[model samples]
Target: MLVLTRRKHQSIMIGDDIEITIAAVEGDQVKLGINAPKHVEIHRKEVYLAIEEANREAVSDVARVDLKRIMGQLGGSE
Candidate 1:
């Protein structure tokens, strides 16, 4: 993990395109402003994790249904 110290109005660059800036600091909360290309995706860590979990669950459900179908075709119990 890369650790950086930035104050309000300060900024950091990621590669050549993405820039993250410190917008405000209020007590324990810190606000950030991010700039990137339209093609890029930026999500909060928790939101990203939830999306990943949902995707995994969807895939798992689809695989289970496929396996059941294959098993029924083979004259096996689902």
Candidate 2:
């Protein structure tokens, strides 16, 4: 991992589009301001991990569904 120190209002750029700015520092907590395009998704590390875990769980649950039963209930060849 790349580690760099930036004071409040200082910014670090990633590629041409993403910028992360230090907005405030209070004791052990630091607030950040990110500037990026709408297509870009940004999430806190913990939140991202939780979302990833949730998605994996959802996918696993879907795999266990009874496809034949669903098809039987829906009927075939509309």
The TM-scores, one per candidate, come to 0.87, 0.79
- The true-versus-predicted C-alpha distance at residue 37 of model 1, in Å, is 1.3
Q: What C-alpha root-mean-square deviation, in Å, does candidate 2 show against the real structure?
A: 3.9
Give the TM-score (vs. native) of candidate 2.
Answer: 0.79
Over 6-55, each residue of candidate 2 has an lDDT whose tens digit, in order, gives: 99999999999999999999999999999999999899899999999999
Candidates in order have lDDT scores of: 0.97, 0.92
lDDT tens string, model 1, 1-78? 999999999999999999999999999999999999999999999999999999999999999999998988889643
Clash pairs of candidate 2? Answer: none
Q: Where does candidate 2 have its weakest 10-residue lDDT segment?
A: 63-72
Q: lDDT of model 2 at residue 47?
A: 98
Regions of candidate 2 where Cα sits further than 4 Å from its true position? 66-78
lDDT of 2: 0.92
